[model samples]
Target: MSTLQIGVLFGVVTFIALFSGMPIAFAVGGVALTFMLIYMPAETVGLVAETLYSELDNFVLLTIPLFVLMGAAIGKSRAGGDLYASLNRWMGRIPGGLGVANVMACSVFAAMCGSSPATCSAIGSSGIPEMRKRGYSPALAAGIIAAGGTLGILIPPSLTLILYGVVTEQSIGKLFMAGVGPGLLLTALFAVWVVIRFRQEKARVLAGDESGATREILREEGFTWREKFETLPRLAPFIGVIVIIMVALYGGWATPSEVAGIGAFFSLLMVIVIYKCWRWPDLKAILGGTVRESTMVMMIIATSFLYTYVMSYLHITQEVAQWLVALPLGKWGFFVAANILLVVLGFFLPPVAIILMVTPIILPALKAHGIDLVWFGVIMTILMEMGLIHPPVGLNLFVINSIAPDIKLRDIIWGTMPFIGLMVFAIFLLAVFPEIAMWLPQNVK
Candidate 1:
């Protein structure tokens, strides 16, 4: 069979396996192995072995586990709660204030955590309840938290960025820097959406009320300065983790892997000393959780490498690269096509799976067109962030729904529309002003 035909068949089978509820690692690995055995010599075991070893051997890959551990530790600590509380107090006076706080807090939490699920859980647990207490609609609260959680992956120290860099041979540090400005921009956009929505809701409530005024509602929900000050110190440890990781990487003090290790070490220490929340048993649980999550991520990386190896061996990647470049579209057209394809794929696959499966095919095409890989990496991360909030298979939607059971799925869908619009706006902004994603990386180095 032609390499193009083989690539098509492999993609179809893998998509089927993914939707069948099979583990992604096994699905990708099994599909790749099947094709390898059918098309290549049995002696090709070395191919799989080398791919697996090489994928894991990268120094940058170490950042995945370290960032995951740091996120897990902070997710379980009191800092998340403190951060949410402070944001609530400061932003709560506005209409939909608590809902606004949820988005703000998630942005803050995203800086510390890189995974969507952890971000959803950490910010949702604290912010969701507060929103409910403030009389915010459940659907609105859930939608905000779910959509906001995606910021975790778009912001710096993102594990997804690390994985993309490892697979595409892009600079992970530069990718992280590229993500910073776009992440902050999206966060601000979400905040504005929350404020506008809050005002509309408040207007409805005031119109419906005969006895109570808006002032009464404000009096009841306003946060005190003392509440904000008390939570200030709790933010220190989380800030420390971010600073250590960024400063170490940008300052040439440590490589990404070493920074990951250092970040993890600091995370553990902060949980124990600063937060004073980890007992021996808690530590054991944290370790166990870290191992379990890290194992899942590493397995995906290994299997993705195996799949990439088989495709490369089959010359599929090169053929696809040629096909993409041969299209009528110029560089901008190719960029548009790629983003559209990724968004469609996002509807079916996990972000990591999508990154692994597609980057091998797409990166070569991108390089051939002289597209900046660092900028592309940030764009890809933002696109993945959009997928996290999208319906049916959106991971962040499921996360918030699970946490707030009373929230109907439709409400989650309806509530996300404005934020989704903001996300799209942010994407266009980045496209028009590439510097939003490129400036930091360019200056840092």
Candidate 2:
């Protein structure tokens, strides 16, 4: 059989494994191993071992555990709750203030945690109950947290960006930087939608949009100017960590790995000293959680790298890319089609698998079209975010589902529909004005 046929077979086998409920790491690595034994000499087994070592040996991977530690520390300390409370008190009276606060909290936590589910759980646990108590619709309240959590991928210190960089061999720092503009854009768009929805809901309640339904309300009391000022200090630890990491990463004071170390130490310090939140037992739990999460991500990455190597050995990826480039779809058509494919695939596959499996094939076509990879990474990340909110397989939807079990899956899907549209709009915005994602990493120091 031709090499291209082997590559197609590899994809078919891998997809079947994934669909059969096999773990992504095992499925990918297993398929690669099966292909290698059949098509290559036994001596080539060493190639898999070498690829695994080289993929994990890099300094950038160190950022994963440390940043995860920082997130775990903050999560254990309940800073995420305090951060939301403070923002809630301040924004509660505004239209859709609680929802707005949820998005803001997710963005801030996304900066710290770099994990979507963590952000969803940390913020949703607090935000959902509060919003529910305030008479917000279950669908609306759950949707905001579900969709907003996706910012975890687009914000700095994003695990998704880190993995994308590792898989594609792009600079991790620049990819992080590129994510900032698009992240902020999506956040603003979400906030706007929330406020607008809040107004509509408010008007409907006042006008009796739902017969006998209680009016959704903003808390008009319990928080004064003085109280708002007093709550500001609760946020200092989280804000300080952000400032330190941002300065270190973009100010050229440190590499991403070094910044991760600094962030983790300070996060631990905050949990113990400022918040006085954790005991020795809590600290041990945090460490264990960090190890578990980091190990899971690293395993997928290592095995996927091995899988990627096998594809290269068979020259499958290049052939796929060449086939894509040969299509008569032209540049814009190809871009649109790729986005559509990713959105559909995202409904079934998680972001990590999509990145590892799909990126190599599309890269050559992208290069042929003269697309800038840094810019494209940001675009692809947005699509991945869309996938996170897509139903049936969007990891974030399930995260929200687990946190707020009262919310029906259908309602959650309905709630996220508008946010998904905003994400698509975000992609279009970036495509037309590539500078939204490119300007920072290109010009920022």
Top lDDT: which candidate number?
A: 2
Model 1 misses residue 64 by how many Å? 1.1
Instruction: Please report the TM-score between candidate 2 and the true structure.
Output: 0.96
Model 1, C-alpha of 317: deviation from truth (Å): 1.7
Question: Looking at candidate 2, what is the lDDT of residue 7?
Answer: 74
Per-prediction TM-score: 0.94, 0.96
- Compared with the true structure, all predictions reach lDDT values of 0.82, 0.87
Candidate 1 residue-wise lDDT, 167-231, digit = tens: 88888888888888998898888888877776766666667752332323322367678876776
Candidate 2 whole-model C-alpha lDDT, 0 to 1 = 0.87
**lDDT, candidate 2, at 45:** 85
User: lDDT (0-100) at residue 85 of candidate 2?
Assistant: 92
lDDT of 2 at 120: 90
